[model samples]
Target chain A: MPNSETMAGTSAAHSEAMIGLYDVHKSFGPLEVLKGISFEVPRGGVVALIGPSGSGKSTILRCVNLLETPNAGTIKVGAQTLAFSKRHRLPGDRRLADFRARTGMVFQSFNLFPHKSVIENVMAGPLIVKRMARDEARAIAERLLARVGLAEKAEAAPARLSGGQRQRVAIARAMAMEPDVMLFDEPTSALDPELVAEVLAVIRGLADDNMTMLLATHEMAFARDVADRVVFMRDGVVVEDGPARQVIETPQHPATQAFLAHFHRR
Target chain B: MSGVSYHWDFSFLWGYRTVLLTGLAYTMAYTVGTILLGLVIGLVAGLMRMSRNPFIRGPAFAYIEIFRCTPLLVQIVWFYYAFPILIGIEMSATTAAVLVLSLYTGSFYAEIFRGGILSLELGQWDAARAVGMRQGQLMRHIILPQAVRRMMPPFINQSVIQLKNTSLVSTIAVTDLLYQGMLITAATYRPLEVYTLIAAIYFVVLFPLTALGQYVENRLRYAE
Candidate 1:
């Protein structure tokens, strides 16, 4: 019934959806992580994946950008599509790289290039991957840094920045790629409580600006406030999929209700 | 107990300074040449060692192990005296010295390069790949720049050892600083002064290099 409902939802917004994952299956050795995962993010739509730690939320986000190739499924982002199955060979590195270029991903740990300065980290994708002119890259980097409210720290090293500042810079770095979609894998999980707001504010700003994003987060309150749709995952499968408010407030599935209960109890 | 007191003099060495200088120049030349060649070999071999294919990885592993386990002195001698017989080709002492030293230094450098790269967190690679950079670009732009800072102290330390290892070439009559000292001892009958000056010259050259390594290490540490 969920699959049919997903199909019905897909066709209703097929023209707008920027990301699609169908029957995605993933495994690590003998341990299966994602079993028949399916979801779609319409353009400018914010979809938050919520679940406990081992619930395959992060795996789903990673698969969206081909960071962890699925054992079986089809993943589509923008104009690129990757189909993975036993019979079909995986795409070559060049093709995969080009496909990945279309999407941006922010990690739990802000994996900024510590060796590069803040602006350089922002400019890295455009300068090295896109082969943009130095002046052009600098201008883009400066603009993105300003947008993220870290323009003053452009010349500073990543080590010099606070956790929140680094995460903001990471957002700017990913934004510089001009990705069709952005994937945030617990972007604020590594930050202190005080630091989490600044990063969440930046992400909220992105959502306000209509950036299509798939966020895997434990921040239930933020997810309800910012995400347009919520996909509740448990044990590698989506147990409930509905509007952000409905799923968080009145989850239909017992699994989802139990998961949200822990968050509300806190 | 009665003991014979030997006269100590270094003034004699001042006259033969040019010979010692030329010998010093040769030592430096070999060191620079072999180090460059060894670095190239190390890079290639290090990369090969990381390759998923056992065919590529196996040879690199064998090469690193062979040179690392055996003595550098024996390698130099075997290349100079015994290798030519096996290959059936005439080999010069200079050629043999350079080849053996480069291979020896390369084996160690390969490990340093590989270890430095491997020490980086997997997240760094993920970040680079996420931005759509290929393997080569990630290694060149993102990985190497950081890894090189970690690699500096060990790299310089290895190069310092390579410089000292050059002394082994003297056994094959290569006119390095040590060989020059031996020749000077023969003619002047001043083994003490001649050998002592040779050791002093090596100290002078190497002390600065070691100091430079520490300076770079401290700078990189503060940079982070």
Candidate 2:
């Protein structure tokens, strides 16, 4: 039998061609944040990326949405080839915005539009960017809020909500766009310890439905429970990639082992 | 001699009522006109200051800085005298008052607009951009509403001050509430009574506007 790690990596990568990054390099001034990173996020599957702070995991996720343009190499999301240095187009290119409309990103800070009520926040992307009708946007926002268990708080401003509720509302807002891919950047990290599970539960439900997801999370149980594969990063490089079972159970890289040991001990 | 039949002379208010009323009308007109014009200019200048290009932001910065550093009275006098000299527009004194008032308020409004935009969290911009909102769309849908909502109180305060500032127009021979009060009191020699009556009229006008400001603030309190 093939090694479980290799099989897991290959199986996870080959599941679908939803997103691919080829030798992506990103630098801010003199500091290189991402050094030739490569990965494939399969459609309708969940992949959890874990690393220390500043390991470039979030930067990679941002590049997928063209939020941060990689200095070198290319990123392909769905059928769109995102901006790269070779193309000489910044991430704010028209196509990048179009591509962003097709992808939903849940921020760590839950930056819900403060001026809008919860349902209005959810409806904003659909109505403003997509030019959808108001009544239709309202209905769709209601449905997404229901999915996230926040239907009751629809008319309330995000400030009236708890951190967890606001994060769920943020997720619903992103989902209301009916995006093809959803990127979660430490969705639960901003919540209180008790609140984290509720947000994670909503994400776990998304995983069960086979929603295309690329999650950057710190919760080990979340990785083991929901992610199809777990990619470990250290020092701006992917140190290990394998099925969640093996990666969590038996990491091969000395760096992964040391990282996990330091992490879990705390 | 001590009893000089001193009573609150209520007749000056009615006798000079038309003049005071006309002055109040001029004050209201100038206040509203300046507020609207200033808000529009401030919005544009504030956005230019926040823009990426140094060419754009630099001039906007200079505009805001120069106006904010200079006194409103100086600006008003300059607009009234120097601007007309520069442009060769022979306008009336009252017209000059309105024009100068708008430019003065425009400077303060620019500061208010810039401060409101800067107060927002940095993450909000990132999220707005991530959602594919163009700069214009983001301002319309996300940024401006929040900024305008946050800015209501200060704007209202400016209006109250603006109403009081209209008294300064008397310096340039434009008859306003204070000037009208002065003309009547000087002629009639009822300084205490006339001034007291003037204070009462100011109360009547400004109290309602301050109340409106408080109401709007209370209504939008949930924005926090």
Q: Pick by TM-score: which candidate is best?
A: 1
**Overall lDDT per candidate, in order of appearance:** 0.92, 0.82
- Candidate 2 stretches with Cα past 4 Å from truth are A1-16, A86-96, A263-266, B1-10, B182-196, B211-223
Which runs of model 1 end up more than 4 angstroms from their true locations?
A1-8, A11-16, B1-4
Report residue A149 deviation for candidate 2 (angstroms).
3.0
- Separate DockQ for every predicted complex: 0.79, 0.44
Per-prediction TM-score to the true structure, in the order listed = 0.95, 0.87
Residue B223 deviation, candidate 2, in Å?
6.8
TM-score of chain A for the candidates in order shown: 0.97, 0.92
DockQ of 2: 0.44
**Which residue window of length 10 is worst by lDDT in model 1 chain A?**
A5-14
**Per-residue lDDT for A1-266 in model 1, tens only?**
44445454775333557999988999999999998988899899999999989999999998999889899988989877778998878787888788888899999999999989999999999999999999999999999999999999999989999999999999999999999999999999999999999999999999999999999999999999999999988788877888999999998888888888998999
Record all residue pairs in model 2 with backbone atoms less than 3 Å apart, i.e. clashing: none
lDDT, residue A260, model 2: 81
Q: B-chain TM-score, every candidate? A: 0.96, 0.86
Return the lDDT, model 1, position B158. Answer: 98
